[model samples]
Target: MSELLHLGALVPAAVGVGTLLAMRRDAGRADVLAAVLMLVGMTDAMTLSFVPPVVWFAALIAAGLALAAGRRFSPVATARPGTMVSTHLALGVISTAALILLMPAMPSSTPALVAPSHEHGAGSTMPQLVGAGLALSTVALAVVALRAERSWVHRLHHTTMAASTVAMCAIVAI
Candidate 1:
């Protein structure tokens, strides 16, 4: 389960990195779609971590619905490319943050947050890994985007993807 979770995030990692390499000022809609799909795969990992599967599923459903509703209510009357990209990035980051904050607090981890079922030793190393991934992605993207000549919307994409990539990595790695 651990290995699968790690592998699953590989897609978003690749997409995030690849978008940067593409020099598009920001990623396209497909990137956002792909990243969220990768996030959904964490359902299995959540079960392995002994968290409630139904809750996670419901959360994912809520997120998907929210995204859809936002799209439906857009001023453009249809989802614009920029809106899609930003929405994906926002959802990805929010979901990742949720996972990171909730994991160690689980009933299974109570009284022994790091040692219960964490084969990786539930040590300080887990949070460190998560923090590093999140920090790197967001910081790099922010620096790159602000100095960029693109429009403000492009800047939003840059910040969103950067923050979300790091957040997702942080979440899944834990």
Candidate 2:
């Protein structure tokens, strides 16, 4: 059931990416890059065992910083004042990184409770805190996305991707 929940979180992300790519011609470079980054972060979250946690942490941080900096420094993001897709995507990536870093080492398929207790230390609560933070950030992004004057497709993509991150965060906190 836990595995199903984890995999289920990926569905919205995949759909969002597909939708964004399908309408890439209409999207700004930042929007397209953000969507791709969100998808990559989600994929890494689900496949954490394939690489070391530290590697995932470093990669995600770099990706998040790059996304944020790219948006801030890019002429496109500066020219467009209303759209916050890149901001949303950067937060999602960073949130995923925090989730990954806080999570105790365990096989991705194992339920959190099923993992050996020793794997969970006094810091086990950190993931829950991070999850809560991510949830709040997701909600804020949702509001921004809804209010943005972008196309419906872009708004939908942002919403779905944000939802996917929240779902993954919730699952990890479980």
Candidate 3:
């Protein structure tokens, strides 16, 4: 079931990538890059357990920082009316990294009614809360993108990214 959910999450992200690439002449390089990064992050979430969690976390953090730096330093980013897309992508990457870092600390399963020993202790609650918060924030960003973006393609891409983020969170945090 979990695997199915993870794969389901990838669909929207793949759509977003396809949407961006299909309109490559209209989309900015930054936009395409952001969509690809989002796709990569979602893919990583699905296959995260294959390697050490720290490695994934570190890579995500570095990617996030690079995105941030690019947004901050790039003349094109500064010239744009709003840097919302770049900011959103950077936050998504960092949030994914944070969630991945917290995954090992989270309970593998929900506590059973008859098995109190299965209950997650207080230590696990923080990660859960953080994951929920990130998920909510991504949803909020999606709403904002729908309202703020002028282009239909951008709106679709942002919405898909948000859905992917929420799905990834559900897979890792739940």
Candidate 4:
């Protein structure tokens, strides 16, 4: 279970980095900031299940600072007049905030979930199912953003940050 959650965290981090690289040519300050914020949140998720809470605590703080700084320093964010800018910031902050709230609530030592084993019931499996659902949702959102008439970067940023939100939910349930 922990391993799966950890893997889940890695997947999005990789995706964020790839998106960051893919967007670098056209990325403004806000886009880069948003990408970095997503990376930080994803990093925190990876640490939550294995490392001490202090690591994630630091990540949470860093994410908060980045969000604030991004909003203040990015000309595109401030100069633009659209929901996209605010939406990215909101998703990043909300995702990190939820992780901050949920970390301590997780059991410190949960037994590993065995595949094809009967030790745990359907109740225990719910988290995995939910995680899968969220993962699928992320894919669907990405596809929608790809096909949307709006600027692909803006739409994709919205979709990518949203992955962080769902990823946190999936991680917590795990």
Candidate 5:
């Protein structure tokens, strides 16, 4: 489970960094897909069983930064095709990339989630079903994101992100 959390964290860092640094010029649909997945993965870190409160607070701060960058991203985000690439998108991608890289490397990291005294957290056997649901949602989003292109890609990513948000919400019930 610790390894899964580490891998989960790693996946976003790779995708977000790749989206910003490597794919900035081309703006491929895959790059957009990667960014979206990274964003979700970052938020999903909060759902892990063993993460501590301070780390959770750090995650909130990071989410605020991402939202700020998302706001900055509106220009390029709304620019007419053939006019310009999105500056806002670039900002969002880069800022989030920085965050994803910084988070897991911190000192005094969150404690490993202990097995719940009652029934709670990712350690709960029942919540694995919820994890399955969350996984399914991400998979669906990935499918839609990878399959779509251009304007449709953006739309699909939004829808997928929305679905991912809801599925993630279900995690709290665990």
Candidate 6:
């Protein structure tokens, strides 16, 4: 499960890098935001102590990028308002959730919040809630995009992203 989780974390990073490559000549707010997300995912996939700081930095940058993208592709100005808003918002949500997941576990002597045994570790409930929230947000974004977008490419991308987010969320929860 841990190995699968690590693999799942790479999916977004790969997609983000691919999108950045595709926009080589004409990169925009979306591309830049995707790059930030890629960095976040890549850092999170690692099991190093330094990962926490890197993920925090990436999450901060991604959050800023999400704001910029949201402004650049405002719903009123963009033809695919749903897609534009949902995509950036989803990125922001996932990034924030990643930050929460990296939070340190409390001491073993502490009482368990939801488990009878101390096996699960501390700060578990918050991460699980955040993971579930991320999954739901991603799924909702995909649905909104599927309903609003006319392009097959975009539809496929949204579906793929939603699936990846679901798996990543499940991994985080576990």
TM values, all candidates: 0.35, 0.77, 0.74, 0.50, 0.38, 0.61
**How far in Å is the alpha carbon of 29 misplaced in model 1?**
5.5
lDDT of 1 by residue, 118-145 (tens): 4355565755665565567566646654
lDDT of 4 by residue, 20-121 (tens): 456544345554555565465455435534434445556555665665566556644233343344334434554454454453334333334211213357
lDDT of all predictions: 0.47, 0.67, 0.67, 0.51, 0.41, 0.53
Please provide, for model 3 over 46-141, each residue's C-alpha lDDT reduced to its tens digit, 9 standing for 90 to 100.
563443456667877888788778767763522336526666667777887776666533234333311222346757677677878998998898
What is the Cα-based lDDT of residue 162 in candidate 5?
36
Q: Pick the candidate with the highest TM-score.
A: 2
lDDT of 2 by residue, 15-36 (tens): 8777656564444665566667
- Stretches > 4 Å off in candidate 2: 23-38, 77-80, 104-118, 121-124
TM-score of 1: 0.35
Per-residue CA lDDT of candidate 5, range 9-50, in tens? 444444444434443333544335545544554554434424
Question: Which residue runs of candidate 1 sit more than 4 Å off their true CA positions?
Answer: 1-29, 38-116, 119-126, 165-174
Best by lDDT: 2
Candidates 1 and 2 compared by TM-score, better number = 2
Clashing pairs in 6: none
Candidate 4 structure, TM-score to reference:
0.50
Clashes of each: 0, 0, 0, 0, 3, 0
lDDT tens per residue, model 6, 1-174: 755665665566466445434433333455456555545544443344333434454565566566555656653333333344344444644554464344333223233331122345684587678777777877786787678767655555566566666766666566
Identify the superior model by lDDT, candidate 1 or candidate 6: 6
